[model samples]
Target: MSNLQAVLKQYWGYDQFRPVQEEAIRSVLEGNDTLLLLPTGGGKSICFQVPVMTMEGVCIVVTPLIALMKDQVEQLKRRDISAAAIHSGMNRHEIDITLDNCIHGQTKFLYVSPERLRTEIMIERTKQMKVCLLAVDEAHCISAWGYDFRPSYLLISEFRLLIPKVPVMALTATATEQVQIDIIDKLEMKPVRVFRQSFARANLSYSTFLEENKERKLLQILKNVPGTAIVYVRTRKRTKELADWLTKQGLRAAGYNAGLPFKERSDRQTAWLKNQVRVVVATNAFGMGIDKPDVRAVVHFDLPDNLEAYYQEAGRAGRDEKKAFAVALFNKIDLEDLAENVEKKYPAMDVLRRVYQSLANYYKIHVGGGEFSAYDFDIQNFTGTFGLIVNETHYALKLLEEEGFIQLSENFNNPARLHFEVDNRQLYDFQIRNPEFDTFVKLLLRIYGGELFTEYVRISESELAQIYFVPELEILKKLSFLKERGIADYEPRRDKPQLTFLTPRYDAALLPLNVFEIERRRERDRQKARAVIQYASNKNRCRTILLLEYFNEMDGKDCGVCDVCLKNKKNEPRPEIDEELGNQILHYLKSFGAVTPRALSQIFENVAEKPFLQTLRYLIDEEIINYDQVGKLTLNSKYHS
Candidate 1:
């Protein structure tokens, strides 16, 4: 076996590759630029991961989400592979050490944010390292036609120029044909090998339930389906409220959102993964890095902003190849609400510029200052003070961030950080002098490794409290005491989102808002909104067919199990029973023997279809007639000559 194949077996325990995985791996190994258009749960990572294991040097993976990067790096480590990630949440020293590891240590993969590619440290260090491959996760974000575009992603092409020999492999779970072409052109992929798996998912039964009381329908669905499920809502408040409602209904459930502390989110996610919780009611933040395979249902409590997001979310169901459902509960009010949301999401360029200037002013940053500075952001306070609508202000800030002027990270519960200030001898001497703090200090040294002496380590106060059988607050106070004594440096975690300036502050009047680009994106969003609305309101076509057609697949067959197909089947006319038709059916059966439903329909030329079917069914039910194993009509013995 080839080394790559052997490595894949060793790591993933798979004897063979999925549809396009082997081909993609081969393309990358051949030093050709490849774009993998795999669906969610299609194992896009394996296509790049397996090839990296076979080759030498580090693989640089540029991704957008910090949580996802960490999750992937952790998974790689669990498989005994060397990997590390650098994101905005990490302090400069932590990032510096991680980069140093990539350059000098035995690290095989380095996951970084797109913005980090432009940093001086990264630029200088990566030049010294041997980079084998460039893998861009969520490559669609580089295209305007994509649903989520980040201006920082465009910087990837310039970075590629610095290492012209390294082949680029872009992968995304969701992308249209236009987005695919745009990815190739934007990333400057040469002689690209495009691998697209069909977007159709036959295991997922897509349905829409139209009811004024969506909560009621949701409860009914949960009761009927009886497996793990996810209910997606738009706002963070609804996530908690709906989760409470589900709990009241006596199902183990939890709310997941960006606002929760990191520890709470981790606990809830672990509970859900372990089947301790039956459902997770959450916003869009909940599902990106989750890999649950037995989720029987994924319901949309509110209308999604676009079809791309909707498809990716709904596709989370039926990953185990078992029967599952993707349901959307909507009312007429939801349609109106969606329109308003679209307007709020795409504020005018002037509003975006105003929000930018206000942010700078809020941070007390001058026009020529604030380069690469991080500021704690309170959305409610900022909006209230400026008299700006909360939703509009949030959306405006997101647009500004996407334009590369600033980088915004929502509330991610980064753990508290600690590093020892004194070496072992001095700390031991201090511990001997202060016996009250000795046990705690000893625990810190024992639990965290010696790395705490050189760099900060993310420490868990709750874990410490559990170990010592004390309150978390007590542990925090002890840590504070140690820090005050100059034994260690500690930084507690923040519970709010942060905004970092990507460039020095620019004057508000000449902030360079791309008017044409912004307007074009707004139009695209409008089109996407209309498409999703149409998908929900549609009652004639199969839901699967509609979704497939939107992704440019016209050859998809009708999924005979969707709500529309089932309703149509229920409405189809059926033949009725009558004495005259009954006699005719019996006589024809006696003469010609058994016939199939289609043939019987054709034989009764004078009789209407439904009436003929009704007669045939009635005779069979009466025992005066019957059909043989092969469906041949037969008279009972009493009627036989």
Candidate 2:
């Protein structure tokens, strides 16, 4: 076996690589800048990971989402691979140790956010490390034409200058042709090798329905399609409401959103993955790093903002190559709301300036200060104090993030961590000198082991309290005392959302806001929103074909299972209906005096529509059955029994 295959088997326990995975890996191994475009659940990580494992030095992975970065790092560690991550909420001491590890060749993978790439410490430390590969996850974010653009991603080119000879691999699941070109140009990839998997899933069926009673339809769909499922709604409140309603109807379900406590979200997700919960009703925040392959259905309870978002979310199902369904249930109001969101997402420049000013005031940061300062931000408090609309303020913050003024991290739990500041000899001497603190110090060492000396270790105060037979507050007090006396560095658990200013606070009046660029982005958002609206409203073309064409794959065949394809098939003319089928339809009409077309269709539902409809039309033309003004079918007087 080859070295790459051997490493894959040893680490991943797989006999072979998935389609296009080995090609992408080989391109990177050959010292070529590679662009990999695989759909969601395509094992994009393995392409970069397996190659780096075969090499000598650590691979630097640049990603935008901190939660995903942490998850990937943990997953790598579980595989016995040394990995570390650096992000906004981490303290300087922690970042120092992590970067030091990379410099000494202790870490095999270093996952850092794009915003962290431009820091002076990161740059200097990276220059010291023996870097082998630079992997850019979600690479489309670097493109201005991409659906989700981040200005910080533009710094990656400058970062590339640090390790100029190391080959770069850019990975993204969804990117249009224009966005693809923009990424290569923005990242300054040299003579790149592009590997694109076709954007079609033969085993997954796509369907959309215009329903007035979406709840009833959702219930019917869940009943029809069994197995683990995910129902996506727009709001957090709706997630809970729909999940509770489904539970009362006898389906095991739970609600999930980012606002919940981290443990609760983790517990809920675990239950779903274990199939203890049949469905998880959630917002878009639920499916980032989750990889459950047997999700038989992913029902969109509300319209997504764009086809790119919808494609990625819906593609989460059927990773095991089994049959699955992606359904969208919407009404007229849903489309209007989706279109109106473009305006809400790109508020006026004055509102953007006001939000920036309010954020500065809320954080008590003076103008021309607060650069690189991170704070625990509560949107409710900020909006309430300033009398600002929450939704508009949110969009303004996002626009600001896109423009590179600040960074907003999703609400995540940063657990309490402890690192010993003193050597073991000093710690033991101090414990003996201060005998009152001896027992607590011994307990910390006994429970956590010696890793706390080398790096920050996550500690639970409640667990420590239970072991020591004291109140939790006592444990907290001891930890604070240790930090105060310089025995150890302690950071309490924090669960609030974080907002970090990327640059100095600017005066609201002269913020240098780019009006023309904002307008161009606003237009781009409207175009994307309209594309989504058209996809939901279209009735003639096949759903799968529409999606394929949207992604610049115009040669796709019609998937025969979508609602549109089935409807068209039913309406086609068939001249081959035999006499026996006509007689059966006539006999049924004779017994039932008058029946609606829908009722008749239901009675003959098992029969193929083309032949049955052709036989019915034959009978109608022959006057054997009366097709009436009320749109009911009845036997003629001469043929009535």
Candidate 3:
């Protein structure tokens, strides 16, 4: 047992690595900068994680997704590995403690967002740590040609200078060849080894349907395919509407979107994962970092903007290597909407400036301030107050984020947290001095234990209220008083989207928006949307081959199970229908007076279905056989006489 295998077994309880996984891990362990291109559910995390465990210093992972960062950190901790993440929502104290742990070698894995890499504190602390590996997840985001181009990812190269000797591993599930080249060039990876798993999903059958009544078609599809499924929609409203409709139709389903309360979302997700809900009707926000391997079908209710996103989302199914279906239902209206969305995504420059100015005013940030400050942003209130259209305002904010002026995070639930500021002895003294709070303090200690004294612990005020036999408001008041008295550090829960100013606030007219880059991006998006339209509208090409070719996989063969392939098979010319076969069918009808198609088929069981059906058609067209009012085949009266 080698060290890599030993580490994998100890942590993951796996006897071996998935295909291409061990080789990728070996490349990283050999101290070479590596680029790993594995499809969704390819276990990319383990490639860097297992090797980092064998190395001497902490591995720094840079990702753009805060949700994924938190998920991975919690997963690592479950395996008893020391891991921490620093992102935009963290307070100064939280960042300080997390970085300190990394520097002091108390943390083995440190996950930070790309924006955090440029922070002075992050830079200084990273230099102090003995960094072994620098892993860039979603590395394609650094590429301007990538579908999801984040300007903040460009700062990673500058951060790389601080840990020059550390081997870098860039990993992404979906990246075109152009984007792949850009990632390496942008990151300045030298002597790089690239490991690309083939993008073809042999087990998944990709199919598209042009339907006039999509709701009926969708229901029919769900009935045809069994097991767990995902029904993806374009809007949050549709998620609930469709899920409720599915339930009314006697299917166990639930709606999931980012806007739902965190607990409800969590509950729905848990129910889906456990198969308590057979289908999850959701938006695109549902599937990141979720690993349910037995999803038998992923049905798209609308066309995505690009093949990259569609591929990633559809690839979520059949991860357990079983045969699954990825069905896309689209109509003419969807294609038009997709085409129009390209223009809508890039709001006019004037609208962009207006939105920026409105955001600054809403946050009460004067010019030359608000740098690095994050605020809870309510988009509805902001647009309503400023008399702006919500859709246009959202696009403007997205444009600003893409241009690096601000960072807009999805609505997230930050639970209430507590940490004791005093030592156990001091806490006891405080409890004695403030005798009124003695019982509550004791209950906290009894319920949460000693970890709350050393670190911030997630606490539920409602649960505490239930336990203490008091109203939830009383629990909140007591927690606030404890913080006021400096007995404990209590942070109340927050559930809102965050908007952080990446740079200082600027006057609306002099914002220096990158018009040329924006134009190029708009063109890129238009091209992507056109490709999506073509994919959905195309009738000649194999769906799997089209997707593979889009990703630059030229050697893909036609998946025989796709709708196109099956239709082509049906239409393929077969041996000409034999006259003897036609005569035999007519003679049978004459001898029996009338016979059902099923009985006739059984009599010609040795013949193929296509050829037999063709013979029957020939006989009927020539008036040799006909169907009676009872719908049974019989010889024509003229022939019988």
Candidate 4:
């Protein structure tokens, strides 16, 4: 037996390991705290998957995204591996069974949300389980200092204390040096092995275009490129529109969004991955835990929130490592719109409180009544009725949830799954005894079991429907039936896009909040928006360089294959331009004090085509235009001289 071949063939059906997968697996099997820093689509799962089989106990993977946990467990179960997840979405029975199973080591991998580790039941059960390793996915979220902060992540350290000997492996696609340090400090893992794969993708090419006809550019790509593609947009509305546009342009494409019923999204994603649908136009909500290797391209219709998110999203392409393309198309107006969107999202305390109050009234909530209540939130529906921007209103709702005013149905946020070992005949007989379980049993019959028997599964009505030939509403109905029956427990799902309302009674002045933390979060969101803008607008550095620097890696050589480097030359300075374009740039400098490449392009919109680009290139070559490290331009010293 090749050392790595035992479980790889017995369980996973892989002949050999991808670059570092074997080493990572060996480290963990050797009982070490291993941090695997692989690029997105670098087979992060197998590192943990391989060792779980060799070990004699359960391997608990702490994941942040409910969908991600569900998808992973689903895939594992497909391969006959036993796994399950315990997260916020499930009812008490589901969690109890999963936890009990973990305790008995019936499950190999038991998935749980970071927040679940904080719960009394989870912690108590975790104490009993013979844990092989504590795998933390999206490990960067634990850092309140990082771009995305979840207070629930703070509970991870508590789990660390619960199982002192259990090794912890924290994994994320994009974490800067600061975020990485915070993950180690926050988790307090001593003597961990930090494994990093090179961030560079030699087979992929990067290109960013400021095009007026963004959709047309996308269409052109679809027409020219062959194989599966993922086009990312910023919102649900855009996901729909772009998908339709691509399909109309003769590309077999579909939309994926958080607002989509889980079933439809799953079917569409499946079709795309199976090569039935040639393209998938989706919001950023898609692409986590997706393992389509032959994707020909990843097209960004809007700027991403940060270099980290962008890298992970873009990395979704070319997973088979045959040549693939990553393209970001933007306009100046989108950048402006992005900034305004940021301002609206970080609403004032009064605005947040007011929105909370409105939600309570809408739901007819009263004091001490939030404990067992559930509500469905519609962004356009709720915001329009309340006279608020949907973006801003959603942000306020999230804050309310964090303050423990009320629990929200995280949009399809089933972090865990629950199932039992009842015989099919028993389940059917129970349906006769308990007619309510009928639909749920029918639904259960449609699914292949991994989540229930192996580990936990993610619970989402719509996602379940996609695997079967059923409607999304029917899927929800079955789960709802199970939830009500007390025989089966299912998570209260936000299968479609939604914001959960917290607090039984929302009062304007009485809600307890950390003023500094709220403001700090607001600042962090703004910083992310700026990063989104900067990534789309920057024209000076190699796309690869911009990403590497963001991750705190310096003194790195450029990837000569990217658009910026290949279109020009390696490390060659920018060009100088003639007077008219230089004058227009100077005028922009005088007007805005400083302007971005995208911002500057907007100022001379009257000029046809690439005139401004040609002019700017000349000015840059002449050293008449000077840009900062972040690509903010100013009047060059030599321009005045």
For residues 431-516, write the lDDT of model 3, one tens digit per residue.
Answer: 88999999999999999998776567779999999999999999999999999988888989877888889888999999998899
Give the alpha carbon lDDT tens digit for every residue of 53-166 in model 2. 999999999998888998899889889998989887789999998888898888999999898888889999998999999999999899877888988899999999999999
lDDT of 4 by residue, 164-229 (tens): 888888887778887888889888878878888878887788888899999888888878888888
Q: Best by lDDT, which number?
A: 2
Error of 3 at 37 (Å): 0.4
Q: Between which residue pairs do clashes occur in model 1?
A: 575-610, 575-611, 576-610, 576-611, 594-632, 594-633
By TM-score, the better pick of 1 and 4 is 1
By lDDT rank, best first, the candidates go: 2, 3, 1, 4
State the TM-score for model 2: 0.88
lDDT of 1 by residue, 495-566 (tens): 668788988899988998888888888888888889889999999999988988888778988887788987
TM-score, each model? Answer: 0.84, 0.88, 0.88, 0.76
Clashes of 3: 0
Better of 1 and 3 by lDDT: 3
Which candidate, 1 or 4, has the higher lDDT?
Answer: 1
What candidate 3 gets wrong by more than 4 Å, as runs, is 446-449, 572-641
User: How high is the lDDT of residue 23 in model 2?
Assistant: 96
The positional error of residue 42 in candidate 1, measured at the CA in angstroms, is 1.3
Task: Choose 1 or 2, whichever is better by lDDT.
Answer: 2
